[model samples]
Target: MNTDIEIVTGFLGSGKTSFINALVESTLVDNEKVLIIQCERGLREIQKTIIEDKRVKIKLYDAEKPLTEEYLKYALTLYRPHRVIIEHNGTRNLIETLNIFNSKALKKHCKITTIFYISEASVFNFYLDNMGGFLLPAVEYSNLILINNINEVGKEEIDKIHKKIDSINPYAIIIGVKKGESIKAMVQKEKILEEGFLKKLRIFFKNIVYR
Candidate 1:
């Protein structure tokens, strides 16, 4: 069976870990095994239930120890997870991180199914202003763009975020998620990927240029 890979990207304190917790608890089906590879440490803690779940496994990699295709292949051979979620480093270049998938060994072992970009509403513009190079490309490539901490901001602010993201990636499914909101149900209800051949073709070329 082909392992399904999903990538989550966001700046520090953007609630990327929290979103993964929600997906594991609410979106994933019963009896499914998953491996979560965290590339960056975040402020939020993984829930205890998730830590204890036998079906879930977590791995951490950082500057001292980096991810490699050989290690990834070994992990797949050992745990043999049905799905893999990679929490990408927020400051790193997304295009470079994506090159990991181009490896022949990884290509045979897994396929990327979704790319999610999460941002805290209050800090979205602030980060964009300082780190637009990192943030903009992530927005353009994501299949789902989640604006978290929506409850903390007003409608005008929320609308501004929506408008800005839409301008960058009209095909992406953008949603505002309030604190403690059930993202699993909402995200599962949407059509996550571009449906038609023409749109997929556009995305293919966009990715080529992006790389």
Candidate 2:
């Protein structure tokens, strides 16, 4: 089976990890071997250890290593994962990674399922005010927008964020959710599965690693 690659993206402490925690929890009911590959700035061992499921595999990458195209190609080749989830570094350039995946070699192996951006409603203004820092190109590239932490930010703010996300990239699917929810549960499979199996997958991704 062609592995499904879903990229879940977001800013730091925006409940990206929390969202994944629940996602894998639900995934255990089905697939036993789910992989979560995380790229962050500091020691996130506690978070890494927390996602320790017999079914889930966690790979952590910190410290500066030359992030060349060959590095990613090798990782994709060796891992041979059923579902590959990447927790991207916010400051990291996503286009570079996307361009690498654009290769025919990768396209033949993994299918790009979805790109989900987890956003905290409270920081919508903060990110908007600091647009350049947020990487407009990456945001524009995402396929889905997940507005999380509705309790902290409130429904009104969520609505505003929706307006903001739509203004930025109208094509991305927008889903409003709490901080922690299962990956399979958050993505309403009914709507997407309607398109058929060849086009459906479940994965998590992120864009922000830190401040």
Candidate 3:
């Protein structure tokens, strides 16, 4: 059986570790074995107790050294995990890391389940101004874009951030989350929006052609 891989990426201090911890705590109870590989060290560390399930393992690597196909293949061989979660580095190029996963050797053993991009609402503009080129690709490639620390920012600011992200990746599900909040409700809301948008689009074209 192939391992299911999830890539979680975000800029520095954007809450990627916190989100991953919450996800693992809420889910993955029944999986046979799971592995979390961290490519960067954050100011805060994920506690062992939070993810101390007998079936789970966590590994941290140096951020300076980029992830290579040979190292990834070796990790897969050693862990033989049922599920794999990658905590990607903020400064690293996500495209390079994605390429490693796309390599024939790793692709045969693991399949990408989803790529999630998390952002801090308050510093979003700064990131766009300074790191836009590096960050845009991650936003475009992600399946879901999460704006964290929403409680600290105002609605207008949030809207601006939302519009910017939408312009880059309209198909991705975008959600605003306060610290320690569950993602289930936000995910459901995204689904409703997607359905409504499609319904409205069809009606819009029908009216234009019929009239």
Candidate 4:
């Protein structure tokens, strides 16, 4: 089976590590062997439980070196993971990073399942104003856009962010995670709902065709 790749892009202190922790603790299956590759060390550390889990392996790389297909192939050979989660550096260009997965060498071994762009609600505008160059591409290509620390920001600001995201990537699933909420649980619920809706639509079409 080809290993699934999940990319989580966010700035430092934007809760990316915490979200990854939730994914490992609650979302992933018990039997799944996961390889987490961190582009750089963030302010928050990975949860201890994840570090102790034999099913999960962690690797850190220098953000300056940039991720390459050669490194991915090496990781695949070494860890033999069922799934790979890349905690991408927010400052890096996502398009360049995504291109590595499209290379012929790594294409057969792994495929990208989801690209999640995480942002801190309180500093959403600040980042947009200062780092639009780095942030825009990530938002445009991401499958899911998660806004953290929503409770700390006002509804007006959140609405503005939503409008901006919709303009950039209308198809993206945007979710606001409030304080004390589980990011993995929320995202999993959204995925389940989307799958359920698609299944119902397929049945409806089948009935129409048969009738």
- Using TM-score, give the best candidate's number: 4
The residue-by-residue lDDT of candidate 1 on 1-211, one tens digit each, is 5677889998778888888887676544555678999998788877899889898899887734546777788888888877888888887878877787899989987888889999988988777778877678899889888888799988898887888888888998887777877766565556443335654454445345434
Candidate 2 wrongly placed segments (more than 4 Å): 28-32, 41-52, 63-68, 132-134, 154-156, 178-211
Model 3 TM: 0.82
Misplaced by over 4 Å in model 4 are 188-211
- Judging by lDDT against the true structure, name the best candidate: 4
**How much lDDT does each candidate structure score?**
0.79, 0.60, 0.77, 0.82
lDDT of 4 by residue, 3-113 (tens): 778899988788889878866665555456789999967778998889998989999988888998889999998987777989998778888899999888788888998
Stronger candidate by lDDT (2 vs 4): 4
lDDT of 3 by residue, 16-56 (tens): 88777765655554434668999976777776775667778
- The TM-score values for the models, in the order shown, are 0.81, 0.71, 0.82, 0.85
Model 3 per-residue lDDT at 133: 88
Clashing pairs in 1: none
Where does model 3 exceed 4 Å of error? 179-211
Tens-digit lDDT track of model 2 for 36-140: 767653322325544555656777766254244565556667765666777766656667667767778777766767676777667765686687444665567
- Quote the lDDT for 38 in model 1: 92
